[model samples]
Target: MHAPRATSNPFVGLHHADTPLLLPNAWDHASALAMAGQGFRAIGTTSLAVAAAVGLPDGASATRDETLRLALLLGSQQFLLSVDAENGFSEDPDEVAEFARQLAAVGAVGINLEDGMGAVDRHAAKIAAVKSAVPGLFVNARTDTYWLGEHDETETLSRLDVYQQAGADGVFVPGLASAREIGALVARLDVPLNILYSPVGPAVPHLADLGVSRISFGSFLYRRSLGAALEAVVEIREGRRPGGRAPTYEDIQSLGADPARHD
Candidate 1:
């Protein structure tokens, strides 16, 4: 296995400053390298994109191997890579911790673990196990309370408290768009608060003002890429060139070129 490239992980320091880390989610190595080329410091894998790409169900613990393979592929890229291992792909905390260790061995700097509204204690156990096994891996504990159902500030805070106590480096609450609630949560947490960026919700500047330390475009880029491809096909079918400029074939292929050759 390739050793982690960075002697000191910059992914952790990205959360310490005032500027919120704008993390773009990538589905594959090419997508990740493309984002890295555009100057993103770090990239996260979107479980939805990964599962859909492989014709598996997301949040069902079905894409464990695929997720690991993607992590192995992207972990050594120029940019820091964070794998979204939904529920750690297992109910057993030990298994989750082992998986995290494997990811760290492959050069991943972070892992995103979601609760999916399961038992809070169980999720916290997994977080503790992962941290115990790989303390350097940034464990961004995610709660699906808002995404999966109604927003309960009390329950959200309760869960986040548990996760923070369990040693989560960051807390992610996706589908949470309310500026007031976000600020409230930010004030309540000791660690960085990660909010998923919604086009219809608060803008990036507004989120930074709300004290959000990280903004994740979770699965948005992947979905938008699919939309763009479909629109391009339809435009061709209707006898018109696509509106936006696309990457040249050579440029796209260059994303997969051996990095050492460039050096």
Candidate 2:
């Protein structure tokens, strides 16, 4: 984080359309900074990772305070920041609008708002209100149709159309592991299309060719880190070596670790 200055919100709007924005979702300040150090121009905050860290339910509107605090902590980092604000944490359009303003003040250039399989009009209105409140903030409206991808994929496109009409700068569809579906969605959407990276699916270059404008690594890193730490501790208790690459003390110092949420 650094002092506020007048600069273009580089991550805002459809700028990611050219080379594709590979956004890694950081749960805390250290992770955000680590990614920035790796030359990532933008980063996203994962609500699932943040909520789980604070023992709150993800996508349940239970982590509004925690989410805001995390934004305050990492908003001024070098990388452009976008937040995964689950359903705006409220159904009311006005309430969501006010939340958007707070996020903008905290220095987030973009936000990912999910529909949560809720009403089409309801999520669309939230997008509208947020754009009105924080016009500079890029709104990547997400639809869970293909995410949960239970039925036909065409239904996902229909949902995105509503979000586009409501003024989303981009759209995200997770759980769309199929190349055919991804290509079709990219061809149809007027705005940038973001797809979550799948380890078992197409690689990054392949995805880029399919016309994906952004690829987000959601809570994958956070969850994997947790799993590694737990495994290491168990191995140590049993007098066995750990199973992964452990960072040196110097690296930890570089990350500026505290007792909570060390990167």
Candidate 3:
């Protein structure tokens, strides 16, 4: 069954909250439900995890079907969902918008579209098409200026300006970590500014202090889960207990019992 639509879009308000929205990126149904069970109000799909789960390369637009399948499975759940659709799986503006429309129809409230350092006008066109196709979908326009290569302050501001004008609900800079620069961007952006959380950089409170509207843990949790599982098996082989929390089989079984779980 499809999830019933909420009376209003709650995702937009999340960015404007007193405290920044801490978005946990989940890979599969169990992980998403597990996070929702922990009182997270929203969950995002990590494209890396999604592609890696199916043995496909990320950022190559190879996980469109996998991404949609996961969305179909988790979209009916209680929490809001924002999918990390890498470049919308197409460079064509209309195609990207159609993909976003499909995502919105399945109950996703937001979509993260990265430019991948492509043409500024082309990415802006995709964003504009998406806004036109699904007006309610929160378009988190991402610019990979720092992610792909050296950080150019001028290019960053210019791309973000075009995206904002293209009707992006928010803007994301994934590799950005400088506090002063982040503060400067926050001071200039008219819409919400989303910063990908870096462990070596500023802490969550520090980002919030800098006026970041949303902080995303992109692929961090998924990678940690993999590391934890590998460590657990190695520890068992060495006749030692695992150092981290391992959910019981029954606990995992409980995750699928309800779409919305309460403490």
Question: Could you say which candidate leads in lDDT?
Answer: 3
lDDT (CA) per prediction: 0.91, 0.84, 0.92
lDDT of 2 by residue, 1-263 (tens): 01212236677433445566789999988888777778888889999899999898898999999989989988876668899999999999999989989999998888889998989999999999998888778888998986655746778989999999998888889888889888888888888888898889899999988888889999988988899989999999999988778767787577765424543
Error of 2 at 103 (Å): 0.3
Minimal lDDT window, size 10, model 1? 1-10
Give the winner by TM-score: 1 or 3.
Answer: 1
Could you tell me which 10 consecutive residues in candidate 3 have the lowest summed lDDT? 1-10
Please give each candidate's TM-score: 0.96, 0.91, 0.95
Candidate 3 per-residue lDDT, tens place, 71-141, comes to 99888888999999999999999999999999999999999999999999999999999999998899999
Q: Candidate 2 at 234: error in angstroms?
A: 2.7
Q: Which regions of candidate 1 fall more than 4 Å away from where they truly are?
A: 1-8
Runs in model 3 lying further than 4 Å from the true structure: 1-7, 260-263
Model 1, range 1-263, lDDT digits (tens) per residue? 11122326688888767678999999988899999888998999999999999999999999999999999998887789999999999999999999999999999999999999999999999999998999889999999989995899999999999999998989999999999999899888888899999999999999988888889999999999999999999999999989887999999989889988766
- For TM-score, the strongest prediction is 1
Candidate 2 has what TM-score?
0.91
Judged by whole-model lDDT over C-alpha atoms, candidate 3 comes out at 0.92
